[model samples]
Structures are given as structure tokens and as C-alpha cells.
Target: MLLFVRTAEAGKYKQSPPDGIEPSTLRLTAARSNQLSYGGTSTFLSIIVQIAQYNLISPLQIPESRILVIGLDDAGKTTLTQRILQHMGQPSKTTIMSTVGLETYEFKDKIAKDKSTYKLFDLGGSGRFRSLWEVYASDATHIIIVIDSTDKGRIFVIRDEIQTMITKIKRANQKILVLANKSDLPNAVTHDKIVNACKFDGVLREFQIRGLNCSALQDTDIEAVVDFVKSK
Candidate 1:
């Protein structure tokens, strides 16, 4: 026998973060249809349950965690994003020009039998767009700061940006992942060196920054990024 099921809904949903965290408002509007064939009564009932799962699941759905990646031009921000996506089996087209403004990459993953979506915002690192970085960073659950390990001259510039972002958020709970990129370069600075150069030695009250060596071009240490996200 042939069976066709169609479902549609439009409404507002509010997702509350863990205790002591702020809540977020989300509007969900979706419509879907599924066509299936049933060989027996048992099979038909199972299909019905599967089709009806959407409505039941939507209300209990977990909100996606937002991740922001920011850095100076030529810091390999975009390259790191592209490589991570590619490693996730979602490769995208590469561009040479620096990001003009804001770009987003979103995907879903299942961990420990729970499924959740993630949104990654890649903001342009040029002087013109740097001003807007804080706006996006404020809402992100985690932030990734990419740095050009070989460009020792930009250490101060990079340090200022990171500090400025922290000051803007004014939150001690912010989770920051610093990627000292271009680790494959012979002259690339070590992660420890990058951390020290950035003056991260100072006490950062509530905000936290963790630095890691990565080479986007060589696809090195990409798992560290994945592990960090999963930990969240």
C-alpha cells in the first residue's frame, strides 16, 4: 500500500540555557512531506510513529551553539574554516579575497545519541570590518582567534584585537580557542611563543584563552578543533 504524510507548523520557541545562563528566542516555521510504502500492518504503524516524531521532537530540540572565528587578514581565518568544513565532509569553494564582511557556515552533528546543530560565523579581519567583530562575538558561545604564526610583526596587532574583543564582551565566562596557524612554515612561531608574545601571561579574570598550533594547509591538528567543539 502507498502512504503519504504531510506536516506543517509555525510558531515561536524559547530555549533556555543551563541555570545561570541567558535564554534565546527562536522562531521556527517548517513544512515537510514524506511518502512511504508499507508491506504489513506492523511496518505501517512504525512509519506513522517516525513521521509523527517531528512535532514531538521540535519542542524539545536543543538550540545550536554559536561559534565565532575572527582574526586579521592573512591570519588564515577562512582557510581554517574551509579546512574544518572539509574535514567534516562538507567542503566548499575557496576564495582568495579576504572576507568583505560576515559569512556563516552551519551544520548538524550527532554526539552520544543526541543531535545538535552548530553555526560558525566568520567575520572579515580587515581594519574596515574589525569594528563589527564584537557585535557577533558577544553572542557566541565560543570564539576562535586565528593567528599567522610566521608573521611575528603582527603580534601586537593580534594581541590588541583579542584584548579588545574581551573588553567588549566583558564576560569572564567566554571560551576562546586561539589557533596559531601556519605551523607548517619553517619560521612559524611555537604555540607557547605565540601565547607569550600575545601577552596572555597577564591575568584574564573570567575570560579564558587556549592556544594551539595548527596548519590549515597541511590539515594538521584539525581534530583539536573538533574536540573543542564537542566538549561544548
Candidate 2:
């Protein structure tokens, strides 16, 4: 999620510093961005949530989410997940490597008023592993696709992957978030180009999908994403 932080006055809080205290809007916005647009070379992330009614079970009823993160190898999926982990206060690996078949990460974010638990599936995106996408997505509440913004040659492959995944997704309201990473690169593609190249208009007609430019490390607000999940 590409977030824009509009902080409040620091003079009000004396004890907490900027790093520990965030006063800005935790904007985790994406496709169907009625109020969002390409903020130039700022930060970029796209969210596609197939809105639907949700069924709750546990009494605590914290925001229970099963997020499926899938994309081509080296698309920065692992890195992006790690960044989100930092926001969630989860223990992250110091040395990140390519995921094997699939890696599962579970964390309960206590920062968002002591609610919300996230279970993320980081699946391998190589050719052989792509087949398992539907298998994992079937039970996932949200699906995230990460793409290397500079790789124009492989954009077609991304289109096919998304289209195929969309058809196989079991839940009609499963949401999707596209992280067009490496946007800060000298020759990276903009949010609009990624959407047009992926033919999102044809594939995501059920949604008012929109895009935004943002940095994965500096601009994401995992809390806003959790808020959306809780809304479902």
C-alpha cells in the first residue's frame, strides 16, 4: 500500500519522537483510487479488494486476515513482506532469500488498538510454483501481486498471471493489491503504465481499480491494509 502521511503537530506530544509517533493519515490506498492518483516518482502500491460480506468465528474477533502474496521471482515480494513485518512488529529475517516452495508468516499486530492478526502466504513465483497459486488463493482473504516496475519485457507475463489467478480465485470478494516495486529506479514504469500494460481495465472491470506511486520501504501503511481487512 502506497501511504501518504499527514502528521499532526509534534509540539503536542513531548515524550514521543517522530519515529515512535506517527500522526499522519495511514493511507493504504490502491486501484479504484477515487481520491488517489499518481503522485509522480513518490511511492507506488495498488490494492484490489473484491468487497464482500465476511463471516466471523472467534469471540475476540480481531481482524483475522489470510493474505496471499504472489508474483514473479525477484519481483521484490519477499522484500515487501519484510517491510510490512517491520510495521507489524514481527520478527523479520536479517538475511532475506528467495522463498522455496512457500513460506507462511503469522503475526498479530497489537499496535492497531490491540486488534488484527495477519497470516500471509509468501509463495514461490517460478513457473513450477505458479500452479499452486489457486490452491493457496482459494482460502486467502486477500491476494497481493508484486512486480518489478523496470521489467517491461516481462509485463506480458504478468498480465497472463493475473488474469489466470483472477479466474481461479475461489472467493468472489477476495481483494488484490499490486505492489509495483522499484519505482524509485531511474527507468521504472509509472503506476498508470503498469495498469495499462497489465490491461487492468479489462481484467478488473468488477472494481474501480486505481494506482499510486510510492516507495515500498518508506510509504506503506500496513495498518490501513489491516483496517480494510477488518472492514470486510
Candidate 3:
């Protein structure tokens, strides 16, 4: 049981508890009957009292979504992430280096109508930095694979890296979005070709995977990425 004090009243003789307080407890008094009485019969007298307004407040709760951005070196992972952030109406640094370990950004998803926060984790995609990516794999709600669509010569290398990474993802609800970036380049291959090269059907047994053609440098198809994120 809790007692809440309402607004303070000055000089007035009447006593009343403000709204929201339990009315049953309003009859309780601090002084004994005899002390509050004069002579044989009891005497009632109203006094000045200061009452503060207060009410119980409930704890707040908000939901968050996590997306991990990864792929081969020079695949434009950071560029793609920043482009997505910009598309989401968030301000992101225009120039960024290849992430040595990890980079993060957050934004609100107004389209969802749930006021959900979207967090993107951009991890270095080089061979030496691949170890760091594993540490965060299990915690990600979704994965974004950025591939340089014009780098056809390294298709097998990218496939090997993707296969190795997908093998460790164990979450049933974790989804994957492969962005075939730099698709505007003259030598860029089709997104379907890149998807086939990754062999996601064979590598990912429990996760949902989809591929999209994009040119992050040109700010193209970024909405498709956000749409995929909002799907969850």
C-alpha cells in the first residue's frame, strides 16, 4: 500500500484528497479522539495543510532490432551500411575507413509504427578480421552480406567465406540479406548469379536468406534493404 500526497491548499477549512487516491483511506487521522476533542464532546477544526501532487508511474519498455553487416574486403560493407542509414533519415559520416573491428549505427523505424530502434553492426570483412565477426554472430537478429558485384574473379573466395560464416549461425529466426552491391558497374554480375555462387540453400539450413541488387555508392535500392529489415 502506498500513500500519495496531492496539491497543497492554504487557509481553507475543508480537507479533501485529490483525484486518483483511494477514498477509503481518506478517513484515517493522525491524532487520537481525546486529543482532538475539547471538554465532553469532540470538537472538529480544519487546519492549513500542504499537499503534494503525486502518482505512481510504470517502467518504460522499448524494442530493438540488430543487423550485422559483413562480407569480403572492399565489398563496400560500410558504404552500404551508411547508405542504408541515410535512407532511413539518419545522419552518418560520409567518409569512413575499412572497419578495423566493428562500427555501429542506430536509427528509429517510423515506417513500422512501433518506434523500434534499428542497430547496425558493421564488422571488418578481411580474412584476419573474420574471427571477430564470429563473436557477434549468435546475437544478431539479421545478417547483411555485401558483395562487390563486379568482382567476378573472387566469386569462389566470397562463396567460401560466406559458407564458413553461415555454418555458425544457429538462431532459427535470424534472417540474411545479401546485397549484390556495385551492380551499376559495367562488369557487375547479376544478383541471382551472386546468390547461386554463395550457395545459401546449402550453407544456411535454419536461416531465411534473400538477395538484392544494389549500388550503395549510387544510393540505389537502399529502400529494399530497409524493407527487408522491417519485415521482421
Instruction: Provide TM-scores for the models.
Output: 0.69, 0.66, 0.69
lDDT of 3 by residue, 99-161 (tens): 654565667854445477776778777677675455456556788888888888887787787
| Model 3 whole-model lDDT (C-alpha atoms) | 0.65
Which is better, 1 or 2, measured by lDDT? 1
Tens-place lDDT per residue, model 2, 1-232, is 2223221222121111234322111111111222212322333322211111122234354236877778898887777777667666778877777765556676777455546677777777888778767766666667777778888898789789878876865554677666677777888897678888788878967643445454554545444544443445
Candidate 2 has what TM-score? 0.66
- Winner of 1 and 3 under lDDT: 3
Model 1, residue 63: distance off in Å is: 4.4
Output the TM-score of candidate 1.
Answer: 0.69
Which segments of model 2 are wrong by more than 4 Å?
Answer: 1-63, 207-210, 217-231
Model 3 clashing residue pairs (backbone): 5-52, 6-51, 6-52, 8-51
Which stretches of candidate 1 lie above 4 Å from their native place?
Answer: 1-63, 94-97, 110-114, 170-172, 203-205
**Colliding pairs, model 1:** 172-206
Candidate 2: C-alpha lDDT: 0.60
Give the Cα-based TM-score of candidate 3 against the true structure: 0.69
lDDT of 3 at 108: 87
- Which lDDT tens digits does candidate 1 get at residues 1-232? 3333332333322222225432222211122232223432223332122121112224245346677788998898888888767665665666644554555666765333336677777777878667766766666677888889899899789889778866766453667787889999999998788877677757344666787999987889988986665556
Each candidate's lDDT (Cα)? 0.64, 0.60, 0.65
